[model samples]
Target: MIGAGAAGLATAIFTGRSSPHLKVLLLDGARRPGAKILISGGGRCNVTNSSVSERDFWGGRSTIVRHVLSGLPVAETVAFFGEVGVPLHEEPGGKLFPDSNRARDVLEALLREVERVHAHLLTAHRVVGISGARGGFTVDTLQGSIAARAVVLAAGGQSLPRTGSDGAGVQLAQRLGHTIVETTPALAPLRIGRADGSFHERLSGVAHDADLTVWADRQVLIRLRGSLLWTHFGVSGPLALNASRHWARAALEGRAPRMTVSFCPGLRFDDADARLVAAARERPRAAAPTVLAAWLPASVAAALASEIGLPDVALAQVPRDDRRRLSHALVEWPLAVEDTRGYNYAEATAGGVTLGEIDPSTMESRVCPGLFLVGEVLDVDGRIGGYNFQWAWASARAAARGLATTL
Candidate 1:
């Protein structure tokens, strides 16, 4: 096994347990493995979601994702963790975290499982190259080189460079004659340009529930509803993260999709207008910002009032044009997305080795015999919850099964 990440660790454990007679080497470049796991989920380590589906992911084919995930279902994962002395508890959005609420516990349990299975895990053994095929293969690492029958590339993609994954695995796959799907930052924060007169700067540090949508070529790309946090650079949080993939892909295509946010989801323009009109009559003496604060943050309301040209006067004293403008702005405010924050801040990569190059049932490389690919190293990225971690687990299991049979 190559790379001692989440998928690599799981693969090593499963492979060692299945075929004990076969020698297994879990190699990683990091001085201490599982850095990503340690920092994941605000250090709690979201292992998996209680309910996961192909719909939660993007890239390759949904059928492939469905097949991989179904192999080792969420129930199996939860049960395995429980048996390994890391009982998990459910949180909102079906997120499963360790009962201890410590990522160290999760990593320690997995490492202990690897040791129990007698898998040799070597840290700082960065794999530099791989050559040969089928029964004979040589894995060249910075530390040394080893001969193996098969190699599994779970080195991950170019996200969180500090964690050790820096797209090295993707480059290795390309040299071995497999097509890459061209990677981009997924689940990243979008950087909004002030060209559109955006008030994002003024609304910084504010967070609220809102509906975000990406529009491209007069078509709705994606719509998401969740908390949005306004940062000085851009928007963060669940809603913005979910919509970022569409925006990034569209920008890559030069389409430059238009992004919009709705403070009141499902509120039409007419309805929003009427609501504001009624508010004018009811809270006539109230400040415009105070009235809008019913749906938005106080800072956001003030920023929107300033941006929409709503006068500083009382709600009822505002001009008709200003009132209607505020209503329209509240309904579907355009977000001037300039670019994504890129791999630096991205939670997962959008693309990598295309799924077509690997068998969905086994995660074995179709282009290169005796080669397997798994996890974020492939063209698969899920939404911000625990879906991505679930993918890592499922894909690793599939690859391990293939290795057990082949070895």
Candidate 2:
């Protein structure tokens, strides 16, 4: 067993219950296991997404996820935790967490299960090398080398390197003849304005619930709904991160993707135009910014007014052209991407080992026997909420089962 994160921990729990005589050993590089779990969901730790479907997951082998996840159902995973004494509460959008609303509770629950099953947990220990063939394998760690019949790589992704996942596992997998997808920051923040950009320093810290869209080379990409955060550096939050994968894809192909925010989600252009005309009639004497401020943040309203060349004129005196322009800007606020925040701030890695290289049914490397890859280390990543946790649970369960059976 490798790693002690959601995937690794869940694997231990299941494996411990499945075959107590297997002598499962979970090795983690972190001194404190579940560091990511501690800070997940702003410290609450979203456990799993309730609205899980095959469409929710995207990657080279998305179809593979459906089959893999079906084998280890979400209901069973939730029930497994429940049977272990951890009550769960679900938030809007099907995100689940411990009833206590503390990530530490989730960690403690898993830790208690590991202890109960007598699973050996060695923290602050790093595996430096692995060598062997056939049914026997040797895992060389900082402390010492241990012999095992199988090994599972659940060290997670390069994102949140502070949590102890720094891509060491990638190099190790490569040595074993597996191809690793060029890893990049997946669901990370997008850098919008610089000190010189028009929107620079204008709306930092201002948040608004809006529909975000990303496009590259005239192709519509990701679209999602969430609150966006304007920072001194750029734009962030769930919507921004969700669109980042598309941005990264565009950049990799030498094309920069631009983003647009729709404050009026699901509204047709004609409807938005009509709304603007009505606002102008009701507050004709008001400044264009003031008119817009009724529906948007004051800073955003002012910025949009400027972008549309409204000149801060009173709505009553504004020309029809200017009014039309303001309507366009309000409906579609365009933001150019200066760049992404890189892996340092990403919540998860987007790309990794291709799904074809691993057995989706068992999460074992089809390239190598007794070897498994799971978690963000693979190309599998979910939208914000608890989908990522679902991946962790499903992949870990499948891998652990394979390891137990093989050993």
Candidate 1 similarity to native, TM-score: 0.96
Model 1 agreement with the true structure over 1-407: per-residue lDDT tens digits: 88898999998888888888888888898899988899889999999999999999999999999999999999999998999999999999899999999999999999999999999999999999999998999999997789999999999999898889999999989989989998889988989887866577777888898889899887888888889999888899988888888888887787858999988887878999899889989988998999988877788889888877678999899888888888889878998888889888988898899998899888999999999998999999999889988999999899888987887
lDDT of 2 by residue, 1-407 (tens): 77898888888877888878888899998899899889999899988877787777666677887877887777887897787787887888789988889888888888999889888899998888877753788988899998887888888888989889888877777788888777778789887754337573677788888888778787777777888888777888777888787788777777667788887776656787788788878887888778778888888888877766786678878888777776676667787777889888888887787788988877888887888888877878788888888889888888777877677
Q: What lDDT does model 2 reach?
A: 0.81
Q: Which ten contiguous residues of candidate 1 have the minimum total lDDT?
A: 194-203
Which ranges in model 1 have alpha carbons more than 4 Å from their true place?
Answer: 196-198
Candidate 1 residue 194 Cα shift, in angstroms, is 3.7
User: What is the TM-score of each predicted model, taking all chains together?
Assistant: 0.96, 0.94
RMSD of each: 1.5, 2.0
The lDDT for every candidate, in the order shown, is: 0.90, 0.81
Top TM-score: which candidate number?
1
- Write out the backbone clash pairs for model 1: none
